[model samples]
Target chain A: QKEVEQDPGPLSVPEGAIVSLNCTYSNSAFQYFMWYRQYSRKGPELLMYTYSSGNKEDGRFTAQVDKSSKYISLFIRDSQPSDSATYLCAMTHLRGGFKTIFGAGTRLFVKA
Target chain B: EPEVTQTPSHQVTQMGQEVILRCVPISNHLYFYWYRQILGQKVEFLVSFYNNEISEKSEIFDDQFSVERPDGSNFTLKIRSTKLEDSAMYFCASTLSQGPPLHFGNGTRLTVT
Candidate 1:
């Protein structure tokens, strides 16, 4: 099985809609989880980061990590067209020299 | 806010030629990494550099690939002999330490003919 897995979703949504993105991992050693947003021809931009399990909120973004289930999620509240981008989930294990593993990004389109 | 910067936004090279991708990581940051993404593919980790040496690398990062921190601010990835499969978007990323999330540069699009 792949170490990290995420659905490559072209999930379309209307303005003001709530969007949910999720990923699952097979490694229990993963300690840091991150969410990144990428536009066409651009690099992944950091959106939210969480350490271990629990939820972290910043503005309209909320990141959740459930270590027991090896599941992670990112929620976007009141989404806008500007939020249209590919969302990538990444994680790293410090004991492994911080070699981050990235999931296949989920493409999102928030229509106006 | 501080950010990582990469030079020569695009590069085109022949299959047998050498190509050098350059980046300037955030000054206060300590860990530097090289990652690449083929068109419509997931980002793949290549190598990680810390304290002026390589800390980790992926299986895809073979002998043909190398990374260096020539100075306090510059981090670079060099491809000794390019291959057709080498064509991809290469990204440079850095973090202040082991625990923080990484900040990435815009990326350099490379095409090997």
Candidate 2:
């Protein structure tokens, strides 16, 4: 089984809708969780970051991590067309290893 | 805001040819990384560098793949002999310290034919 698993969704939603993207990881050592947004042909852009098991909020985006469950999520509120992109969940162990593992990424489309 | 910059936004090289991908990371950043994503695949880490030395590398980063911080400002990844599977989007990233969010460049799309 892959260390990290995420549905490569082409999830379509209307503008202003709340979107929930999630990922499950099997590695128990993962402590740093991150969410990245990537547009077509562009590099992944860091959207949210959280350490350990907790929730971190920034503007319309919220990142939640549950170490025990080995799950992480990114909640996008008031989604807009401009928000359409691929969302990637990335994590690394707290031992300061730079070897980050990433999910396959979920494709999101916020319609107008 | 400063950002990582990569050169040769797109490259097409013949298989077995040598290719060097270059990146200019944020000036004050202490950590540098190279990652690649094949078509429709998750981004995979290649290697990481700190204090002018390689800190870690993945199995994919073999003898043919090497990284160098040639001038203290420019970080580069060189593939001694490109292969068909080496075609991918190569991203260079940097961060001020460990455990923080990484700032990435637009990426260099490599196509090995």
Evaluated on CA atoms against the true complex, candidate 2 attains a DockQ of: 0.75
lDDT of 1: 0.93
Tens digits of lDDT, candidate 2, B6-98: 999999999999999999999999999999999999999999899988888899999999999999799999999999999999999998987
- For residue B9, what is the lDDT in candidate 1? 97
DockQ of 1: 0.80
TM-score of chain A of 1: 0.98
What does fnat come to for each candidate? 0.74, 0.70
lDDT of 2 by residue, A61-85 (tens): 9999989899999999999999999
Each model's lDDT comes to 0.93, 0.94
TM-score of each: 0.98, 0.98
Report the Cα interface RMSD of each model, rounded to 1 decimal: 1.0, 1.3
Clashing pairs in 1: none
Question: How close is candidate 1 at the interface, in terms of C-alpha RMSD after superposing the true interface residues?
Answer: 1.0
